[model samples]
Target: MTNDEKVRSIRSKIKCMKSTNEQGFDVIIWMRKRFLQSEAFVKNLKRIIDAGFIEKWTNYLNLQDISQRLLAREGAIKDPEIKFEEIKTIFVLLLVGHALAASVLILELWYSKRSRKY
Candidate 1:
């Protein structure tokens, strides 16, 4: 693509990436969990994500100011390799998240117990 075209593309993408108060990854997860537990759609997820997602995701991550430097709680570590990883890897995490929290908290409980063991 031409330089001008590329710039326009990037600018358009950036417009939709406000990470704070806009990016709703955690909210999405909460909705999904709620749905499976009660076999009901607890909330309208589309409205929760409509503002940012149809816009774009990675661009949203960039525009977020989530205070990455803040210390972790209990037992957590900020690994550089994990941060350097690309956004494409999120699909893998999605699969993992779905499997862990699909229709009930059983999978979640199992994973939590196992994760702590290691």
Candidate 2:
């Protein structure tokens, strides 16, 4: 469907949902959870997001913000190898930290044993 058509569909969904009072929040929550593709739909989402703020639906607004951030970051890590390397680097750092801690404990135990013998 065209972007304009998607915008109309989204608006209609919101309108029907609005008739049920609190269901407006449900519509916003649904939109926040879905992967909206159309630019127009995204724009509509941004515009309607203010309704959540005005309604004081803090949790829903936060979810919308998180979803928006996820969408913004969706294309940032397009390379699987790059992400794998990042994970590998983090894992190596954690392993090094654990090895250092273990070595310190072993040295402390050996030192205490030597002192006791003296």
Candidate 3:
């Protein structure tokens, strides 16, 4: 079949498989099912990739995010560089939470000791 025909076929099949209220998470679940359980779907998708038409197909289907995620899942996409600043921010927040808890405990201990002396 022609590329346009294939796209139509894929679009119809996917639409039928999807729920009316489908969102990003739903699409991920659907894609996982398609890849894992539907041999014909996987074969067609492989053909699209092999023919260098994956971008076209994904764009046509409004599945750019899903395609990127699929590539990431398959390890075709490399991991992004880690940001030390983000990690440092998280660490600082955790430290602040710990300090708050420790302060609360110390206050409780001091209150208990002062009460005992009264």
Cα deviation in Å at residue 23, candidate 2?
3.7
Tell me the whole-model lDDT of each prediction, alpha carbons only.
Answer: 0.48, 0.61, 0.61
Question: What's the true lDDT of residue 24 in model 2?
Answer: 48
Please give the lDDT score for candidate 1: 0.48
Stretches of candidate 1 exceeding 4 Å from the true structure: 15-19, 23-118
Question: Per-residue alpha-carbon lDDT of model 1 for 1-118, expressed as tens digits?
Answer: 5433433443344444345555533221222322443222212333434466555565545544443423343334556574535766797888888976774688777878889953
User: For residues 28-103, could you state the per-residue lDDT of candidate 2 as single tens digits?
Assistant: 3333334555575557675775456434454566566667678778755343456676689899999999999999
Candidate 3 lDDT, 20-115, residue by residue in tens: 224422122244422444556656665765675744554556576667768889889976798898699899999999999999999999999989
Extract clashing residue pairs from model 3.
Answer: none
User: Which ten residues in a row are the worst by lDDT in model 1?
Assistant: 25-34
Over all chains combined, what TM-score does candidate 2 have?
0.36
Q: Which segments of candidate 3 are over 4 A away from where they belong?
A: 1-66, 69-76
Comparison by lDDT, 1 against 2, better one: 2
Give the best candidate by TM-score.
3
